[model samples]
Target: MGGNFLQSRSAIRHEVGQYIIRNIFASSGLSLYILVDTVFIAAAGGTFGLAALNISLPVFNFFNSLGLLFGIGGSTIYSINKLKDPKKVETLFGKLLLFCILLGCGFAILLNLFPTQILTILGAEGQTMAVALGYFRIIALGAPLFMCNYVCVNFIRNDGNPQLTMIATLSATLVVVFLDWLLIFVFNLHMLGAAIATLFSPLTSLTVLTFHRKNKQRQLKLKFAFPEPKTLLKAASLGIPSFLTEMSTGVSIFVFNWVLLKLSGNYAVAAYGVIANIAIVVLALSNGIALGVQPIASREYGKRNWENVKTAMKLGIQVAFGLACLLYFILVVFKTPIVSVFNHDHSAKLAQIAVNGLPLYFLSVFFASQNLVIMLSLAAIERAKMAFVLSLLRGYFILIAAVLIFAKFFGVNGVWLSVPFTEACVCALGFYFLTSALKNKN
Candidate 1:
């Protein structure tokens, strides 16, 4: 090529690098803090406490996922649009903000009103039922804040303010960790304290959000607008797949929890909780790595820069494998100490069982990483249907099948083993879809 070609390539690479740092730093930091905080809470609370927290986590994550749908789906679209039509970006942001707020309130009311019913469906029996209800009720109080914070942070990243997003998340997490210690340990409120601390996290995040938006948001004003039925419809259409992908996990977790509780007892529930809890920590980091790849892929796809998209996928997979390896080592090496951090001897065998199964659980990180790339990359390119298809394969179809078949035959070990098998299957399918899309595009 020529100097012009070389300069353009250099610019693309620079943008990709910035995108990577911002995506990984902001997402990973938020996930790590939350994961660590969960582990610490489990440790402080004991078997029942941890089980209750674990039981309730899927519900909380589901709500958070709603935020992900509008915020992330909107942000990606918004970013691509700004690259071309900067003036029209506000329409996108305005609609999403409005829709998310309404949905947030709706979800809050539904969850609060149906806490007992929801917990019962999710396998709450005795104390597990009580603790789940307590935790759920408190967190339900902050639903509005939770939804708003999602829009704010994702928008910051969309606006190319990763540093601000990182700082904002870190501040909220740091505050939650401190408050968690004081409320759960010093005051001994158990699940109630955990719930309050959970509420405080989003509140702190919202504070940072307000500060960030007040200063930097010139493109999109956040005033309350009457519900735009079309905006909510569009968001739901574009975002539903992502929303379902996460919602499926909540369903899966309930199944997983119920199965474990059935196969063993409270100890088993607590043990599996340890594994699930740690998995969240790793999954969050993996998500960070994958999300870092998203903007690069999205921006490149916008300009039809397919090679960078492919390379970024490769890089994200490598990062995911590297992270999984690190996590595997910790599980194998420090399994006892880490498990101890969550529970004592009551869960010793369960912890060992978890350690035995840790590597298997992460074996598909490479594939999982690729699947994530294809999903978001497609969505970023406005291929929402394709994204939904892949999401369904991984989240619902493959995972559900794997869990049932494996768990039926192998028991709890089967439950753990299902992760990789399903991930590999869905990833292969995702690859097929991505290749077809590329062929059609080219």
Candidate 2:
């Protein structure tokens, strides 16, 4: 009996570790879509290009968030119901995929029709406006592809083929990187080339995901079904936290751009572009860790195996903390070189602002990482209200208020401190919710 217990524990750890490692790579690769774009665009068009990219980012975030709304939410529901109600799970992927396609098409049409109006609302103007228009238009056309790719990847991962999801993401990222160079440099397409390369990202990911059908263990099938209102609402409720977590980044960027433009100028916004993109990579890492814990926790929760659920959460928090520490150290030690990569023209103002903001802004990750794990864990166990509350506080309410007040009092440095302060506060609330929920359950 004792040996059996030990073996069970060991098996849990091994399974969780495998998910974490593969997801980190997959998530990081997904982020490179923007990170690599930032690098090449900086080289191609310099400050204006980088600043324009930042201005246009909120739209990209919106597309990705909508995908998560359906993908993560639908997949979480699928995971919980897959074993108990296999027939119900069959139509979920189909319904969610149809929902995303229709929703994505609507966004694409609107964005293409009113590029200038939308970009202006996002704070793009002057030279940045011209650069953003071309880039944003190209990106808009790929919305369906992006949303569908995300939906497919999430369901595939939960369907017991995380390895294929990892392969698809990494491979697509590699293709985009090469295309970024070929289109942006070789073809001299500049910003347009960069946007074109980005379109290839979802295309490649989707193509690779097609191979999932070849898996002998695969259960998910792409059956087309019109979404039912009741089912859509349920999945949306489960996915709202993830959607908000992502949109919060977009909303924060939109707010920050408005504030920074008033506080400093375009240079300040450009500096923020560098810091924010790096922050995206960090958030992706944290999300990867959370994603790894999610399927396991959700599956165990479905089985009513509370002990396994707790164990998975505990392991997730540990991994998040360790990775956060290492990431912060690396960011601080190499701040100058990192900033230089984005500051193509070596503008002193851009350098100084980004260099100073890198460490201050990144200090949030330590808390942010744990918050992500807790939020996702809460969602997995069907404690979505708590997860939504944490997401709102961290991404919307607390963050917006913090940035506004901090910038008013401390200027740009205060702007940098706002995220850390918000994450720290949210972290406290998250622990309270987690402890209360677990205590009640146990």
Candidate whose TM-score is highest = 2
RMSD of each: 2.4, 0.9
What's the TM for model 2? 0.99
TM-score of 1: 0.91
lDDT for each residue of candidate 1 in 299-369, tens digit (9 for 90 to 100): 77777877666666666666666766776677768776776677644566667666666666667565665
lDDT of each: 0.71, 0.93
Structural similarity to truth (TM-score) of each candidate: 0.91, 0.99
Top-scoring candidate (lDDT): 2
**lDDT (Cα, tens digit) per residue for candidate 2, span 83-197:** 9988988989999999899989998999999999999999999999998999999999999998998899899999998898899999988999999999999999999999999
Where does model 1 exceed 4 Å of error?
Answer: 2-7, 213-218, 305-311
Instruction: Evaluate model 1: give its lDDT.
Output: 0.71
Instruction: Report residue 137 deviation for candidate 2 (angstroms).
Output: 0.7
- For candidate 1, the per-residue lDDT at 199 reads 74
